[model samples]
Target: MSATAEQPPFRPRTVLLIVGVAVIAFAGFLLLIAFAPPFQGGHDARGHALSTSGNGYAGLVELTDAIGSHSLIVRDTDLLGSSALLIVTPEYDSDGAQLARLLAARAGHPTLIVLPKWLTRPMPDNREWSLKVNTIWPEGAIAALDKIAPKLAVDQTPFRKTVIPPQPAAIPRLARAAIGGQREQQRLVGMGFTPMLLDRDGRVVMGKLIGRPVYVLADPDLLNNQGLADPWTARQGWQVIDDLSTTNEIAFDLTMNGFAKQADKSPLRLIFQPPFLPVTLCIVLAALLAGLHGAVRFGAPIAAGRAIAMGKRTLVDNAAMLFRAARREHRVGAAYAALTRDLTAQATHAPARLSGEALDHYLDRAGRNAGDPPYATLAWRAEAAEDRDQLLGAARALYRWRRNRTR
Candidate 1:
């Protein structure tokens, strides 16, 4: 046998099935990636209302859900305008300019700004887990407080951690604030801050801005995931919100906490956004249907005809083309003369051994006997054509001789 490589080990059918399954899985993964941001359900590990981590306030949100209190996590900056009490947890690196604008807009509404304390990094092993290395610098926390209360500063060393009821009217609820047992002993300490709730040593734990309706919570541990571990602390946090909330929908702002989703004009991003999402789904479905149709299609392949055909007619046409290409037009007349000469000799029953001149003389006598032109003369005319007109004349004379002999 001739030396040749063997075919691949895998079957075509199995390969096709694997490819189809892989394509489907990839499409599912893309869909998951597109919808993950909006439908995350507040499972992040950052120190925000959307996080379920120790430093986060997601527990407070869960507490509201359990008590039948209406609350929502706000991802859009536009939602901050609602009259409800917005619990905003601003990160250390949050935009101060944007924070000022947001606080300014809520002049008529109730706003509570919670300052961040712990600085943590996400665990590489678990996405939902995080490790609080240490506390954020007092200056960094103060900068976040500076947006509305630039005069105030964040202080961890309070003379006391418990609230001191200085204002009889505000202390009724402030005194009952379950902000005790905080992980980081931090509070707002400065002059311009109107002390709504203060420590025994006069540190502002929860205070209001001078002229604005915005409130500041210096320590977030009371409402954070760690603080709300028990039922009592969770209820205290809920009570604080109930006392503050003016509107039916309580909103916790996530926009300032690095969860803001801006409009992306990239083709991949656009397809995952509104309006185009349906188009993307349709295109995927169409492709799947087309693939299915191709896979299940039935029929044996029809054999194709050969490029070069075989037959007397095909042979004649090819010879004609060759003669035309070679500029041997006179050769056509010579071939016709030889064919007619043989046919006439056979018709006259002439001997096969006869020479060319003898054959022509015998056919000429037979042609004269039949009341036709002499065979020699007809043959000479047929073999003498040099151009198109001459060739036509030769073909005509030869045809007549053959017809006369047949008759």
Candidate 2:
């Protein structure tokens, strides 16, 4: 019985599937990292006081509280009672500010209004007791504060005390620092409030209204954290509060004109609000589609076989064709040289070479000596021949010479 032949299986579809899947998976991974939101660290001024235990107003919180409390009292009723309104403004919108404002409002004291720094543009003309403070810590304001309040000034000559490093996202660094006397002084002056300026050396340089109903604490740090624990700071804060509370209505202006100047322009009204959501959605959809298509189409296995096709002509065939083409173009000298080199290579496989005198001596040795033909007689007449007839004669002579040599 004849043996049955085994046939190889075809697997083009399987191979394509594997490649497509790999491409899709790589794209999905890249998209996931690109569209993910960044994680925020730390809390804001409002949250810092409630979330953590300690002197909550150690930094900007103290300043914000002071301004916010003052504003609330001025806006609502007289400060004669403990139930005064406190308004807190945020450098930006944040949960901490919201919580602080809500807590202050519920206390039956002052209603805390949380305003972001960006809202400064449409500020009302008569917001008597409104206080606006940045949510983020403003370090630059702290440096400026050192120059405004004599009681709040510290030894910043070495410049070491002036520099405050960035804090965790939860910690309001810069805004807190700005509550220092200098910032408060500037803010008061801008808002039509009486502010006293002090030099860095702790000398009061301006404004002295000791008995005025309105008492402003430029540096809130003097009343927060370690400052709160200090005898002088606490006494001073109490004195200022008591003096201001004498009036039927006490106003805390937490809003600083400096902050207004630095307030970032609203992006909502800008030419192009960032298209984060739309961009993210498009990227996610593209990734999902690619993955699904790859999974569905590339589930098969690939067959193992040679994918490249083999050519019929080798190096020798190529050289022969090149020589033939050159001869057809009337390049008889180049064609003849190529033919001679090929014949010589084949003949010299024996350790001896056929060249010059040796070639002639070998012819004689083979007893086939003949008179040498004129070298010029072998010249390709095609180069000088202008007519096709002369070219044909030259080609014929070349052919006859090749034929006789073979014989």
Candidate topping lDDT = 1
lDDT of 1: 0.74
Clashing pairs in 1: none
Question: Per-model C-alpha lDDT, please?
Answer: 0.74, 0.37
* Number of backbone collisions per candidate: 0, 37
What tens digits encode model 2's per-residue C-alpha lDDT throughout 249-281?
Answer: 333322221112112224321212255556656
In candidate 1, where is summed lDDT lowest over 10 consecutive residues? 169-178
The reply for model 2, stretches above 4 Å from the true place, is 1-221, 229-235, 238-276, 293-311, 314-407
Backbone-clash count (model 2): 37
TM-scores, each model vs. reference: 0.57, 0.31
